[model samples]
Target: MTEAELQQLIFDGLRKIAPESDPASLRPDQKIRETLDIDSFDFLNFLIALDERLRVEIPEADYGKLNTLDGMVRYLLAKLPK
Candidate 1:
């Protein structure tokens, strides 16, 4: 998928984790936890949802590096097929 498409997927999945969040309005650089209030469970759900969509397993240890939307996008980009 394209970067923008990946970004949208992450946004959509995260928005679902925090139903009240306005993912569309969030800036690309915004931190998912601080800005979107995504707790540990929500983060795990996000990882699971993304993994399902991308058909890859995102290790739990790597999840710590994805504390922000941008970070997550970067991580996905690295994991996704080039």
Candidate 2:
């Protein structure tokens, strides 16, 4: 998928975890969990949701790389097929 599409997937995942959050308003350089006020469980669910949607398994050790929107997009793009 394209980068824009990947970003939308991230937004959807975040929305699923935190319905009150405005995923579109998230700062690309900021920490998504802290910004959304979500705890670890919710964050794991978010990542799992993204994994299911994108068919990409994100290793737990790589979780830190997904802290920001920009980072998530970059990491996912690298994992996704060309």
Candidate 3:
């Protein structure tokens, strides 16, 4: 998927976890948890939702790389099947 598409997927996952959050207002370089008030459960759910939607496996060790929007796109781009 293209970078823009990956970003949109991430935003979609975030919205699923935090419906009250405005994904467009989130800073790409900032931590998503802090930006969206995403608790541990929300974060996990977001990851699960993304994994299911994207058909990508996000290992627990790499979860830290998904903290920011930019990071999430980069990480997913690398992890996605070529």
Residue 64 in model 2: lDDT: 93
lDDT of each: 0.81, 0.89, 0.86
Candidate 1: minimum summed lDDT over ten consecutive residues — where? 60-69
Among these predictions, the greatest TM-score belongs to 2
- Please give the lDDT score for candidate 1: 0.81
**Tens-place lDDT digits, model 3, residues 1-82:** 8998888878888888889988878778999899889999989988888888888888899988888888988888998887
Candidate 1 per-residue C-alpha lDDT over 1-82 given as tens digits, one digit per residue, 9 for 90 to 100: 8989998887789778998988877776777687887777877777788888999777777867787677778888888888
Model 3 worst lDDT run, 10 consecutive residues: 7-16
In order of listing, the candidates' clash counts read 0, 0, 0
lDDT (0-100) at residue 75 of candidate 2?
94
Clashing pairs in 3: none
Give me the runs in candidate 1 sitting further than 4 Å from their true place. Answer: none
Residue pairs with colliding backbones in model 1 are: none
Question: What stretches of model 3 exceed 4 Å from their correct place?
Answer: none
lDDT of 2: 0.89
The superposed Cα distance between candidate 1 and the true structure at residue 6, in angstroms, equals 0.3
